[model samples]
Target chain A: MNSHHRWLLDQLPQWERDGLLTPEAVRTLRERHAVDDSQPGVAQIVMGALGALLIGTGLIAVIGFNWDDFSRPVRLLFAFLPLLVAQLFSFRTLQRGDASPAWVRETAALLQALTGGACIALVSQIYNLGGEWPDFLFWWMLLSLPLVWVLRSSSVAIFYLVCIAIWSVDRIERGAPWHGSPMIYPLLLLGLLPFWPGWPPKRKLSVSVRWAMTLSAIVGLCSAAIFASERGSNFFGYNEHSFFWLWTLTGAALALFPLNQAAIMEPTRRKPQVVLGCLWLLGYGIAMTFRDTTRYIMEGSSFAMHLPWCWGLLALLVVFAVVALIQKRWAVLAISSLALLPLAASPLVKAEGGYYNSTLSWFATLQLAGIGITLIVLEFAGKKGAPRLGAALLSGLLIARMADSHFSLLAKGIAFIAVGVAFLAFNILMSRLRRSKQLPAS
Target chain B: MKSLPILVFALAALAQWAAPLSQIWTHEQVLAKGTLVRLKCRAPDPYDPLRGRFLAVWPEQTDAPVPDGAKIDRGSQVFFTLTPGADGLSTITSISTTPPGTGIWLRARAGYVYDKKVNIEWPFERFYINEKLAPEADKWFAQNIRGDQGIVAEVRVLNGRAVLADLSLDGKSFREILKERVK
Candidate 1:
């Protein structure tokens, strides 16, 4: 039997002896969920993934040695060798995997994808082929899609996400515009929808699958954000406000998405998506409190509604809010509302005292207040680790503002002392409230 | 039904191999039998990670007369028919979308328009070289001189396809220069 089932079987006898389960019940349960030794275990899946990665990397390195003395045909053979082996493995997996273990199929699919990339890269090496990195990655991604679709392997899907990350980064480096079929990324992502967490509800995702999904989702969103902002900044004469709004709105949506009822419930409390999203939100919030950040939006056009990304950002925010509302995710709805504040305030930033001098300070203050309130609410809702993080964020913002603000040394010192006192008083008050609640009726 | 996955895998594999192989074949064919034209070009250093390293180049400032009121649209494919100048360097005699009837011609796209001069980018602008040799090459060419003339490349043109056949500075191959410098 696979190790998971073996462990469960071991536990049942102990449970029966303890009277937690009757002997008959244990027998029935064991019979219902029969353990099959032939099925792939978690170790097998992990080992298979590692094995594929190693073999692929090894073959590429062998090719990289570049035996230039070899004849052209020999070199060509070397180029195709990895691909041939990978294809053979894939064929075997396809033939046997229906009766074989999940690991076998997953490993074979992963190897096929990796070997395809190896073929592309090694052929380029062997032929001394010169092209754009993104083009190479695009070829790899395109080639791997069939394996992902045919086998429905999560590993290949992760690999595809990695390829997209590299490709998008390269595209951005080349200063490509967003309008050049930017929708292709999301469309490509749609092909792997069946492998996502919620589909086939009874199927549980392995930890690696979860991590891969979380990471790829973040990378995909960030890439789009980067592309959109870069397009605005370079082509449309939009200032840093465009980037900030786009980034924060995307961040807020990702962070609050887990709270949505529509979100797939994970077996674990600390979902990777939620964690990543919170980090983005908090990090962006902390950044807005800094003085230099104001310069990003100050020099040029502060915020023009005419810029394409501005409208795009607003539209995305509205969509996220609408979705959150439908899901009845109060936290997400509340967080998404933060997007409107910048839209409302951007026009007001161009005031009598110049953009930075008046608007930045107020905006920073409002962001801090909003984040602080949100964290406090989340902490009360019993989100583990929120209280400490929320307090740290608030204190860090206070310290940063003090460092750059117009406050006198004496005023800053007084403010610091006051904050310290307030924290102590709040802690004392909270303890007292808890103590009183714990007390018996008087 | 069992063969479906295998068919899909084979097709995908063919596609992956076919794309680069086809590009290489076309370029190789042009390199082998295409007509050669030597043109002076100016260089800017750029590196493509997958493609190793090369110089991003532009044609030397030319006094080639534009046909009266030719619309210079950026990124639109345009052809430049080549002719030997007094200096024996290839120069654009005329620019059009249609192929020229006579001597070797270039396939280039019209870049940004400045006054009446339309900057055109030749499809074979890149001169792929060893990654290690690029920094030195970039420094050498950034001086913008080939023994009192600009750097020149012998570009091979076949039908509409162009391939960079050879890059020379002072009539010396870049490889020879690298070898000499290494010694």
Candidate 2:
């Protein structure tokens, strides 16, 4: 029996003795909720994922090796072979419908996505096709979307998110043209949208789903940070600084989205957002506090805001704002609202050459001060992990910046001692708070 | 409802396979039954993300007349009337968006433009080989070809479409040259 079933068995005797349940009722409940004997465990899932990956990679290597020997038609035929087999497996799964085992359905969906990508790569090799990397990724994603919908596959959705993150990075940082990536990215997220609604009420998601979401979220946020410019064009008049501000705001919104949900308030359910979003926010906060970061953006004197990506960022911000308003998450509302201040300030300062440095210094100082105070407040409010890490990170960054700016050695030593004392005090206070029931037990 | 999704998948599968096949078929038909013209061009090696490495090419038009106010856009099709020179190498005499029916002309995309001169990109700019041979091809092209005298390409044109049939350097085809070099 699984751990959940075991725990239920342990509770049954106590429940009957305490008059919470009768013997007959306990027996009926136990029979109804019994664990399936044939359900695959963690080892099986890991092995299945590895097997699919190996087969996909091996298939590509073998075809690429013998690419010259085969006739044109033969090469073309081979490209479609793996895809056809994958489709046959998908057809069988669909025919079985819900009667198919969970493992069988998931494995078929995973193979389908892999083989489809392989098919694309093989065809491009045979034809000597030339296009940007994101174009190839976009086609692979479009072909896989139907499989996600037909199979109701969380695995394929995760796979799509992984590709979206990669395509975003390629398009943004490598100076590839937009190619509708900004628009298509969010639309693709809808493939995974169904999974969230169908999530079980009182249980954690399977380990594979949790890990996939975490990895995708991290990649997505990091890609946003690398949005240096829209190829050669700058849509937002203020340059990279404005996009940096947009990314920071987007990170905060992603972190807060899951937090506001009453149904998903459990720590396990909230782990992906907390780790990905809050860590990203913390890292951005640290980078913003540095003198070099300000100098990098302030050197350029261009300002105007119009691009598809800028509009896409705004659309996302509007969605976040609407949700925050509906949920009455006042703290989230205030943090998101703060992004507009720098958006308005940077362009005006940039129009004139002399004030750019002064404007950036003031902006950096305000962000550092704001983020530092917020981290401590979160720790006091009993939000663990991210708050503590954010606080440590903020303090380290402040110290590093202060030292780099040529503060006296005496002042630096005093600052370090003061930070240590503050941490000690925080630890003591947290323990007392926990004992007195002033903070909820984690 | 059950058969509906399966039907959609089948259609998507057919379309995916058909798109690339149609491209190959069009090129094959032109190669079999079209007018062949040898054009002067240059080749350089470049990497394609999925296909590994390929030789990126530029076809040189030494004596083509410059047109007035012709705005060339990348990926936009343009018609070029071809005439063979004394060396039996074809030179573009005129270029336009609409096809000229009187003489043999090949359809090509307007590539890079400078002043009155435009570099038309033939459909076959990339020549794929094994990934290991890409660096060797790049080295050989850099070493042997000089001053637009050695490089030549035979292009088959039909019904406003063209396909690259052979690329030669100093009288030998590229594949034959590579075969000798490898041996």
Candidate 3:
């Protein structure tokens, strides 16, 4: 047995003596047998570095070729060159099973990285690319995704995430004018879902990767929302309310449901981490609604008076505070301070519209009052009720805005009444569902 | 493992070597006009409207005909047939045909006319074709007697239809013209 197995065995004897190694535990241990051996050879290291250098050089040369002058066929062939070379190299490595595992892994990693680099270069070369940025990004992401599986490289996965994030931003910027294509950004997160609490490593690296992915999602959503709001005329904008809610709901399902199910099956101690990540993600969704609201108020010239109802912004700050308190996460607290700026700035900036226009003044007051009422209601809802209530309230606000924009005042009032009734009915149904789930079955 | 890196390095070296082979078309060569020649429409610097960029074609062997009475449409299509003039430059002779819309306007002289309103006849003798079509004449002179083996041009006409016709290269192909540069 290798040193790692030996070490594991050494620890097991004491555990067994202590009666810790039950039959089930022993079976699990046997299944996870480690065979860590000597460090990689000097030759292997040299070969890996040489291979990487060659691949890099080849990529540079191919991309540097006057692609602009080449015929379409020639340009396409050049684009696939690196992928072909990398795949062939990978196949050759796999065929030579006699090679050291470390060597195989290193070679695979190099090939994977080169493939990713080549893809980026090839995409940069596609000529006369029109306004379909999202579709373009989605295609690139999908093309690069297989490298993650083929090479088993997290780096490729990270690259894929970055592309998706960029795509999301592009989608948001195009607004309603942007028609949907086959590319779905949510599917990508699903692709990465299996790698969560990724191959055990130092805590710092794992946390950072998790944080990085989360931050990317947040930035992507925020950018998309901003784009949707501004892409059309200053008055009419894309309805991002449904988009945000659906995205957040999907995100929650992916992060929470899968992790919970996996934890039950694996009996792993990482369950809490998964839960924490989901909660933080939920908080982020709440936070985004407010951040977007604040940005709209500041940047949107027409809606300057509606600044007071910017309570979504304050609600977001509170959500962050609650998250920090619950998780005792210092990072959350540090970031929460940044939210204070909007609160301080919004009130200080005097209302810019004419005072004689009661429409502007009344709208501002209604916003502040509405936000104040929502916050009070949320405070009564307490910790357990906050997430669902926040979601419902935000959805209602979006629906109201859409109605007001698209319908007559009479129609708007009727729609508001219908929505209010629907909300109450949903709340009652949810309570019953909760009650039934909480009760023990006979 | 060691071989992997070495293989990569070898591939890189091979790529560097292969890159230069494709750049063989960059050099210029001279050919005589009316020497059957070929021209690849390679716009060297793509037109950048924002930057006010444009390409100017200067033909050294053949000059465009300037019509005397009719003003040439600034962007109208005109054809050329190679005929050595007194100036020793191959000039385009005008052949009558329905303007731009009907059949092969084969006998049309290659020249520039001002607006149709001016009615000026400035026929072949002003503009010149690229001098590169010169050495191409020797090849045509030796092998292409029937005119079947000469350069044919598909010129984009005013109505966007491509009109295919034999460009009167005295007797050469673009390859033959380029070959002179090596000699």
Winning model by DockQ: 2
Docking band of candidate 3:
incorrect
Pick by lDDT: 2 or 3, better one? 2
Local accuracy of candidate 3 as per-residue lDDT tens digits, B24-64: 11110111111322322211122221111122222333334
What is the clash tally of candidate 2? Answer: 6
Please state the error at residue A280 of candidate 1 in Å: 3.1
Q: Highest TM-score, which number?
A: 2
lDDT string for model 2 (B26-129, tens) is 76778788898887888877665555666766676532444676665545668889889899888888987788977788776676566677666665676667
For A282-333, candidate 2 gives per-residue lDDT tens digits of 5664564565565444332122134445455567777877876776554344
List candidate 3 stretches off by more than 4 Å: A1-10, A13-58, A61-84, A94-106, A109-142, A170-172, A175-183, A187-216, A219-223, A231-257, A264-442, B1-183
Question: Candidate order by DockQ, highest to lowest?
Answer: 2, 1, 3
Estimate the Cα RMSD of every predicted model relative to the unseen true structure: 6.2, 5.7, 17.8
Q: List-wise, what DockQ does each model earn?
A: 0.22, 0.33, 0.04
Error of 3 at A291 (Å): 14
- What is the TM-score of candidate 1? 0.73
lDDT of 1 by residue, A357-394 (tens): 45665775677666666766664775422444456566
DockQ of 1: 0.22
